[model samples]
Target: MDLEKRHEPPLRQTPEGCLAVAIRIPVRIVVLVLVVPVRMVWDALVVVGRFLRDTVFRPLGRALSWLARAVFVWPLVALWRYGVVPVGKALGWLGKVLLVIPLTWLYRQVLTPLGHALVSMLAWLYARVLTPVGRAVAWFLRGTGLVLAAIAGGVYAVVAWLARYLLVVPGRWVYEWILAPVGRLIAWCARGVLWVLEMLFDGIGTALYWIGRVLFVLPALALWRWVLVPVGRVLAVVGREVWDALGHAWRVAGRISLAVGRALATLFRWVFVEPVRWAYRTVLTPVGHVVRDVLVRPVAAVARSAGRAAREALAAARESVRQARADFRRMLLGEPRRVEALDRREPTGPETRTLGSSTTALTKD
Candidate 1:
């Protein structure tokens, strides 16, 4: 039996081994029952997720992106390219044709010619009327200035000559004729007075010396040496001691008071003044500056602009009124009437009498 068992094939190669495999078929059945449905459900879920991604989510995402681009970006691009750019170019072309070209032509044709005509008229007026008038006035003024200078020179010469004659001649005559005798007489009188004064002063000084030696000098020396010196020494010693003690106490008290005053001042400044100063500098000052700059300055500027505009309007109104008055007058009366009226108002020769007199004086000079 051992030989037959050893010579037999392995169980896997035998028919009974097939029966043992059949006996364990419940495990395979259980594995297939549990795992196959789970795998199929997992595969079905994956297929559904892929189908949803491709069919619903991806298309929806692409549609949303396309809708955003169409709604927001395409209109703006189309507007910039087709509407705004074309409109801007058309406006630029219209401006160049209507405003710039016409203005340039008007300036070159009408305004430039008008300006040149006005300049020529002004030049003619300046040359014909103003030039001669200015030259005549300048000549008159020059003659007047020359006459004034000549008169001033003559007056100065006369004054100088008179001064020399009056002062120098009189002074020389006085000195030679009257002052010499007077000065000699004064010298003689002064010498006599001085001699008398010298004699009197010498006698007086000798008497004063004797009187002071007896009455004042001896008493002053005795008083000072005997009484004043001892009293002064005692008083000086007592005063020095009192002054030293009082001065030392006062000095110490003054130092303490000064220290306390300084400390109090520092504390007061730190507590009160610094905060107020800081608040004023940081808040009130800036606010005041802002009010001045932002409110006051703009108001002043606006007022100035309004005043300038009003003045210009008033000037234009006045000019219009004057022109209207002139036109009304021209319409009411003939041109000859205005000319005759101007002629009647013109000055005759008598009106220039002062000027003629000045001219005559200038010619004479």
Candidate 2:
């Protein structure tokens, strides 16, 4: 298995050189050194930004949003809800009363009758006045068309006789007897001349093609194959290796930056966070507890007690006032009669039913 694995083809990779190897270490080192401080500062800025967002900016945003709503949105909403909506409704009612009702009445009483009368008048005019004029015009155009058609037939006959004798007969005789022989002779001579020219041009083109091939095409091919291809290959390899090196260096720098960031974070946690947390826990927490227990709790308890007593006194006074009002009302109007409830929930009456005391026709006590 080991031999087979060793014999197996390796993965295909672009070749690298000593130059790439030489560049990699220095570039990564320089990038790491440059990135560490930036990463630390970035992390610090990120932390501060988060702290500000949570503590300051969030509350400010909420307050600003509330203020904006109170200042702008709420007033607009109130105007729309209270002013615009009521006015719109009133306008709609007025439109319905003033415009809609009046227009509807006018349309029904005035316009509809007027439209019917106009339609009748138009129908009468079209039937009585315009129809006969149109019929006469059509008849006149029909008679004129028939007369023009007869005149056109006579003109066409004269033109056809003149064309056949003077133009068609003479042209046919010239084409068949004289022009035909001359045209055939000219075509035959042109064919022979074209053939000779074609052969001559073919020979010239072949010679030129071979000359150009030897002069330009073969040399260009040789240059492209031998010179440009090798040079381009070398350039492509160098470019690819340089790009790969940059990517590898950037990744290495990112790792270094992460390590430095973590180290700084640990240092900050120990130096600043731990001490502050310790002070808050050891000193401030106990002080806060003492203040809350000694001053705040007692004051809160006293306030709560006073408030409860005040509420009780107010409730008692309200009850007394209510009773006095009731007594005075009773003195003026006497006591009101109380109605008895008629709805019952029980199946039997006050006493439980027994067989001996049954009130049915079958059994009675």
lDDT to native, each model: 0.81, 0.88
The lowest-lDDT stretch of 10 consecutive residues in candidate 1 is: 14-23
Candidate 2 stretches with Cα past 4 Å from truth are 1-72, 82-98, 121-152, 174-224, 285-365
Displacement of residue 240 (Cα, Å) in model 2 is: 3.6
List of clashing residue pairs for candidate 1: none
Give, for candidate 2, the lowest lDDT window spanning 10 residues.
345-354
TM-score, one value per model: 0.25, 0.56
The positional error of residue 215 in candidate 1, measured at the CA in angstroms, is 28
Best of the candidates, lDDT: 2
lDDT of 2 by residue, 188-294 (tens): 99999999999999999999999999999999999999999989977776676566655665666567767877898899999999999999999999999999999
Scored against the true structure, residue 114 in model 1 reaches a CA lDDT of: 100
Q: What does candidate 2 score in Cα RMSD to the true structure?
A: 8.5
**Local error of candidate 2 at residue 342 (angstroms):** 29
Please give the lDDT score for candidate 2: 0.88
